[model samples]
Target: MSKGVKTITDAEFETEVLQAEEPVLVYFWASWCGPCQLMSPLVNLAANTYSDRLKVVKMEIDPNPLTVKQYQVEGVPAIRLIQGNNILASAEGVMGKEKLISFLDTHLN
Candidate 1:
């Protein structure tokens, strides 16, 4: 995780994302996923860039099966924008920094 990005667990998912005051971008990833490694830097950048408006978090799928199942994460490198316990938007696979920013912008405003 990056400086502004929080690495959350299943136990913290409710408070960190569901009840968050601001919008949260949750990155569902695994240590062995190639695309997830590729998407990490961009996620970190987004975390720092949108720190004021969005709270970014990373949840490792392997150890947090409950959260992954709850979110219905079918694949690694899944990105979900959540606000007030609702999912605003979601995407899967590796996305570039610009596209990731655009994704965040789409729901933030």
Candidate 2:
């Protein structure tokens, strides 16, 4: 994970994401997922580029089942854009850096 990205757990989900002052981009992934691995770099890039406007967090689904269940994440490389208590947008699968940036930009603006 990059310095701009934070690794969060189920216990910290509410405070880190739900109660965050800025918009949060939560990456729901598992260590064993190949697609998640592929998407990691793009996520990291987004984290670095959007550090000022967004809070990027990675949540390993294997250890954080409660949050995964709550979000109904059936696959790895799932991303949720959350602001305050609301989920603004969500996407699944591996995305390119441009697409990921566009995803965030759409909701951020």
Candidate 3:
């Protein structure tokens, strides 16, 4: 299921996300974050669930400097649903499944 999701790097951030033709859900996390470990499955599920309307991608924050700073991502387990340069919605830390789905559905309609 998560195989459909792409693990992105800062180098590919521009072409893969910022230039994407459709809305993108960018999940920023760190390998050492405990909540991030728990949130991974939820993120992947969201990727598969919203595949038709979203281009879901995950980025490891520890190694990705440019995007971490550019997006003002100050912590792990962060999500930014964006289209082009506009961030349609965003969330930090962890959330419940229903809330997560609700967050993704915000602008997809």
Q: Quote each prediction's TM-score.
A: 0.95, 0.94, 0.94
Estimate every model's Cα lDDT from 0 to 1: 0.91, 0.89, 0.88
Tens digits of per-residue lDDT for model 1, 7-78:
999999999999989889999999999999999989889988888888999999999999999889999899
Q: Judged by lDDT against the true structure, how good is candidate 2?
A: 0.89
Backbone clashes in candidate 3 total 0
Colliding pairs, model 2: none
> Which portions of model 3 miss their true places by more than 4 Å?
1-3
Off by over 4 Å in 2: 1-3
- What is the RMSD of candidate 1? 1.9
Task: Per model, state how many residue pairs clash.
Answer: 0, 0, 0
Better of 1 and 3 by lDDT: 1
Per-residue C-alpha lDDT of model 3 across residues 38-99, encoded as one tens digit per residue: 88988889888988778999999989998989888988899999899999988889887989
User: Residue 2: error of model 1 in Å?
Assistant: 9.3
